[model samples]
Target: MLIHLAYTLTGDRRCAELQRMDSERLDMSGYAYYENIWGGGAESMFRRKASVVQHLDRLRVGEHSLFEIDDFIVNGGEGPGQQDEHRRLFAPAVDLNFRRFEQDRRAYLEGGAERQADEEAALMRWLPHCRRKLFFEWNAPELVNRLIPFLYLDTYLSLLRAERSTIEQVRRDLVLGLNRAFSHLYLTDSDNLYVTTQYLHSAEQPRPLVRLTIPLSGVDLFVDGRPDMAYDRERPDLLLRFAPPPALALRPGAPMPKLERWRLNLLTFEYLMRLAHGGTYNILADECELSVRALKDQLLSAFAYEPAEAGLIEFFVAERRRYVLKKIQIDEQGHLRSGG
Candidate 1:
């Protein structure tokens, strides 16, 4: 269905052909639905609160539970016509809680270099490959953007676990103790709800200017529903946010809006890391089919760094390391740093 939708949207023949050939090339039953690895049984911290993360495709309307698709469709919502399924697609919005990282927050804020390193190290323990460049850089290439939601989720999950929330609460609410490969769990009500966090520049100061954005694709609620002959695509892509929980008052004043870098919209940072490690620049430029100068421009654009600003990062990707990209980190002084 998604492949067909992609084809419909992009009018890409390749997407259409892939949908047509799906049965022959892919195992639908084994992979059609992602397992509820990030959720506990019903009664978790979310809307249902069943004490576990449940993955059944059931909906509860007040006291009555609706499971069958036809029945759900038959029931009418506040909207005219058969909009039960549409209305069932969402629920009341709720605020997300993440006020659990204050100690580490203070460490990162009050402590100096060692504290910053310790904080980052703690975060890495949860999602090791979470590259730092994504947050610090201006913007990202498209592929990287797709992973931003998952990465940010991990950042918070790390904090939640580090704070030692209850085993069950962490298991269910924080989405731990599960075989989840990715980090988001979409619920019927999740579309209406968004995650938010707050921090202080100091104990009394609110860090309001640093707008931490969850780079998300546009969402359009289809009132008319699509031609699938059943119902509408209900869920929105998972949206999330992670605060550096940095101090507000000391933050530098910048009149110009800064570009964000947490999405997959940038080139592989590993390319530059490779270059930095002594790979030939001209040779790599040739392999990627661009002149050294043109490649350099793209590289500069990827890093959002210019040598004059000391943000410029130079690198070399050895032949064997072509696909390897490194993570980008920002130091307290805003200098770019890379490791692991």
Candidate 2:
């Protein structure tokens, strides 16, 4: 279904390759739905708890589970008209939940801790049934937008096992992750943006000012427009307060605004590791007609040290080698830092 949707959206025949790749990646089941469900389950649960994070096809009404409705449509002893009628029966409830979901989403974004907690609880209570709503209404513009943030948030939350974290901590992580996601989307040329703790500055004289932008690209709602980095040409001084970045101070219900070059977040690191260790990188190297070492050097430039920044990137490299490649053992302690 998703591959069909992808092909429909992009009209690219290559989208069919996703099916082939997914099949290759999975076991004899010939499908990856279960692995995806289990592998990303915590992230999905966290995103759902955080906000309404689902596409239209995934939406459910109270008590009328998707599977039940799907069965109804397939074998409800009903004709097309009857199935349409049954589907419409749940439409009002779905609409109501959508409105409420959007309202709570706005409240969570605009409200403080108390309001956020209240909304979270309300949404949690609404989950079992609201998640089961079934309908074919594609009227909601925000559905697709809601879906994107769920995946983007996982880029950060999964690394830390965010399900165990406090509400405040989860919100903080979401804010940071969303910023990282939109920054990459608006600023970089690559689809896979490598977000790192490291920062870079230009060496040219009278260096052009790079505005730190916080683009909320469908953070919880569908943003109709794209981020225009050209708009930031006026506010170069925004770089001074890069610590939190402007996304932290964005007013409630603020519009999406619009990076620097070359960053590497942990998500990208893990992906690269999997590719290299799984031999995918070697296949890519072979296909590209480039030496593996040469291919790696091209990517390594993003992690390389610049004269302006500290050696944090170097520290990351060393630690990755020690803990990952060498599996070095450290002196165990009783604290949280200690090896369990």
Candidate 3:
């Protein structure tokens, strides 16, 4: 029935009787869930509108730009049964209706309805599917961030193969976008979580080595009823402290032998220095004779001595480029010079 109506509408059918019936049905049943969710009253409508507006503003976009009708309906999380009924009853003719509406808006300005009619015709031919509904409803920033990578993975891979951009740069951008979106939606009260990359090339493909750093003040980590030691805000050293379980004895000095500790510290220092100079993890692992897993475990454990403080140290170091770049200037001859 919907397909038939869509075909008719797209073909510019002048069936007033059919149009009136479809419009009435849509008004009565298709939007019933929206009314129910907003509570079929004036007050509820206002509240729903306000909530939507607030969410839109937080997304840093205008209301219409933030979401389409499909996004609104799908994110509402109505039951599957209701959705199926709606699709079966009215969805066939209204496939991509929101997109068509946008076209119609443009047509109204350009003095032509041809594009709008074409879109409506295309929608009619394309059967509305559950996946479309899913896309519409999952509108949260965090959700979009998480899904965008997967959605664009094929395009990204294609671009990588074409050598349009370096893999490392692409991975860095992906991590930054993911972290920014996550922070915006879930960590609203917390500062941005900076992501640093350590890229490693495998036999088959390259992988991103990711490090997440959140501000010490933004996180609360407690062990054995004691607050974790704070890191020096100005330093690059991360201090991580963890309480030993009752079964493990607490030692004041280093956990490993002195020789081993010294070796590990040297390795760690070299790795940190290389990372500061924009070195890749592949280079570090090769130089230090450490497996990726081993390096990550040791680095994470090293900070456990004073987790909170260490976190801040790492945070500052991770963001060092922002401040450090300004201090280093190049002469016309491309000689590097440092300012006091």
Candidate 4:
């Protein structure tokens, strides 16, 4: 029926041939009905085929006619208008089947079923490649866009067996992973834009400015000087800030570490503080070649790592500063005593 319909909609000889071939292959008795309806008169068949081919070329997977085909199967060929009734019948079955398949696959993998795991992984990988080709050939941007949401979903699913972590922690990791990937693609100096001639001109221009008001908590912490302010919400707020570079721009591959490196240094300091205290702070400062005051200011502002904290934070800052001073031999070299 679908083949005949496709043939009728598209006067494509290929579609008509496919209908005939499938009908013969299936050995269905209904082939006669299709022939009588569509293969009778030359003008009727030609006109119908032309119309059907044109329509079929425009057919999208989720559009109205698609559901009609599914409905036809579910309701045993009662046809178009009965879609609403059959949809209710089929929807639950499809959902249940998908859920069961996922559960069974997970259970098999958990039980060390290597063969099943390999098979499932192979099938999953094949599906995306097939989908990409279909979407590209059909020029279906909507279907392609639908696939984008799954990139993160798939990333999370891939990490399902990793060390158990709280949902909040996992969510944070996912956000960081996505941010890293996006930054690499869109913001990195060696990104695709730099290599492509078409994008090189655009790359030379500064990225468009984005304005974001600091959160009340952030404002209270920095502007109001409240170090005790902690976020109570499960999700951390993301703030994007921009610092326009100096007019004497550094060339590509320059040694300058930029703001991202500063942010990373602050995070590293916070992590180290959580792990230990009473270490020589001078070591860290010297390693990064940062003055004590500059390092302190950067850590405080970038990560909210307060030196006033009683235990880990204060101990960490003091020890790190001492370590920096000693390692660089700042007293003998007189390097740390002077400004850069």
Candidate 5:
């Protein structure tokens, strides 16, 4: 899957020469593109949207009128799930200004609920496919595209080719293991070892959370040189994490790589897969405690050596994007073939 940004002006404007977005305000962007990672902002917040489109008078900058930006909407899908996967994505451009005056007139009638009801009825009357494009679009990721840096295209393409196999394995690991781990991380001991992705300090407390954090080297927990019985107990914001095995966990470096609180499924999958593979490929992280250095180290360590070009990276993870190896057959000699 791919995601891109589009912008348009909305809401009522009294004059032509409207102000542009401020740099500092735009700097405080709340974009969420990495579904597997929760970095506060919109991820922790609930979002609400209105279907109605906003209309504004033409913007004017000095004598000449500002460029008019029309609302654009796009919606399209293709083929069956089992087919050749000739899928296409279109963000379909639709114009919502057609009935601007009419909608305005309807706005005041009978408190406008009547017109709203009529519009809904009329939409229901039309062919279902026709209404797919009419939606009030809002994507925080797209809003902050201005702040996103461009990739070193040549270097990225080369690296993609060089590490295709590693990439494929990662995809498979994530696609198959994430949800499976989420369902079972708590089953490690059942009687103890709980995890909570919230805030609860371990410095000092009256009833301190009995959170067991396993380090990379240690297999057991000891409190004052004695086994700590992690009995089942109630504690708010408690988190039990199986910390990365030292060699596998990257140390924090400067110009830190920004990471988020682990999305539970991804975190669990990382741990379970590491256990299964007899090696760890990740580091533990807490929500609201992201380190840019750790992120940079993880990527560099994955390659064993640094590349020449500066890379631009974006995390894209979605459960719905799982892969299917359809119509494949394995030969007796351990060869693979596409059957269908």
Candidate 6:
């Protein structure tokens, strides 16, 4: 769907870019060399392409609005009895600027600090544009719901990896910003749980920790009554603490190890995956504008961390880029509906 839409809307430029991508893939060890867990064989590709073409045809003939097309793509054309493992789980098109940012970030990551300035420059230029497009220009609320979380995550990662003395101040601002934004987007079941990445320490263990803390008075969510339990204990009902997985744990009194930025991202994502699976954080959809349940479903689908593989982290980092980019593009095109 994204390929067809890009080709249709952007014309020769998109076509040239696709051709160039194909050429680059061919120049690799082989086409398969460029493929990953998120990729499909020719048959599956053709099947998706065909379905998207049909949807595009409908749009061209005024049979459906861009929102309708977006609905079909994000939700799929399946009925209740037809549910399958391959069901659509929050697939949204991201914008061109984000697409390029991913490419540039990858290059910088692989090439080391030499390209850091370029990557940072690109993000500074595009973050506002992408935000504006998602918030104001785009009308696909479903897609936007699935996407903005990631935008926040990526922005957080960028700030974390930056070499600056004001990082703590910036991080606090990010957390507060998330609180302000998510307060409007999500509602809890008498449990105000606001989840985002934070860097803090535990008294019992002075290592990097992923803590979930809720500050309910009488509700002992942990049930164990262990004061050492560093779960969500701030103001939310459940506290989920995720530390560096055992394999990545650091030694005592060691200098702060420089983690690969995406590793931090994957750890945070893994924590969210656990939260989504537990079904403890109940988001009231009717009470809010965004379908956060759908967002969680998408998060579960996109970042399922268990049943791990060798390069799962790498695959997820790449897939995250594509998923966000697709959602942005879909939302941007929502301006096309004459009455919608």
Please report, in order, the local distance difference test score of every candidate based on alpha carbons. 0.27, 0.32, 0.34, 0.30, 0.26, 0.32
User: What lDDT tens digits, residue by residue, belong to model 5 across residues 119-159?
Assistant: 54543332112222211222322322212121222222332
What is candidate 3's CA lDDT for residue 187? 18
Instruction: Indicate the TM-score of model 1.
Output: 0.16
* Ten-residue region with minimum lDDT total, candidate 2: 235-244
Model 3 ranges off by over 4 Å: 1-31, 38-42, 45-340
Residue by residue across 1-340, what tens digits does model 3's lDDT show? 3432333233322468447856775422222222222222344333344444333223221122224333433332357865564454333234334344334333444544656676445433322232223334533444333322223434333332444344334333323333322222111112322333444455744334324443423222211122334532332222122223211223455463111011222243334334433444544354453432353354334433432212122211123233211133345576656532
Compose the digit string of candidate 4's lDDT tens values, residues 1-340.
4665554344344556757755665332222222322333445544355545433333222222233332233232365544453344334222223234334334444546556766566444323323333333334344343433222333233233332343334333322222222212222111111110011123334222111111212111001112334443342222222222222133344443234122222323222222222223333343332332343344234333112212210000114323111111134334443211
- True lDDT of residue 3, candidate 5: 10
Best by lDDT: 3
Number of the candidate with higher lDDT, 3 or 6: 3
Which candidate number would show the highest TM-score if scored against the true structure?
A: 3
**Model 5: residue 272 alpha-carbon error in angstroms:** 9.6
What TM-scores do the predictions have?
0.16, 0.20, 0.22, 0.18, 0.17, 0.19
TM-score of 3: 0.22
- Pick the winner on lDDT between candidates 1 and 2: 2
lDDT of 4: 0.30
How high is the lDDT of residue 87 in model 2?
49
Report lDDT (Cα) of residue 327, candidate 2.
Answer: 16
Give the range where candidate 4 is weakest over 10 consecutive residues by summed lDDT.
Answer: 188-197
User: For every model in order, what is the number of clashing pairs?
Assistant: 37, 9, 18, 26, 14, 29
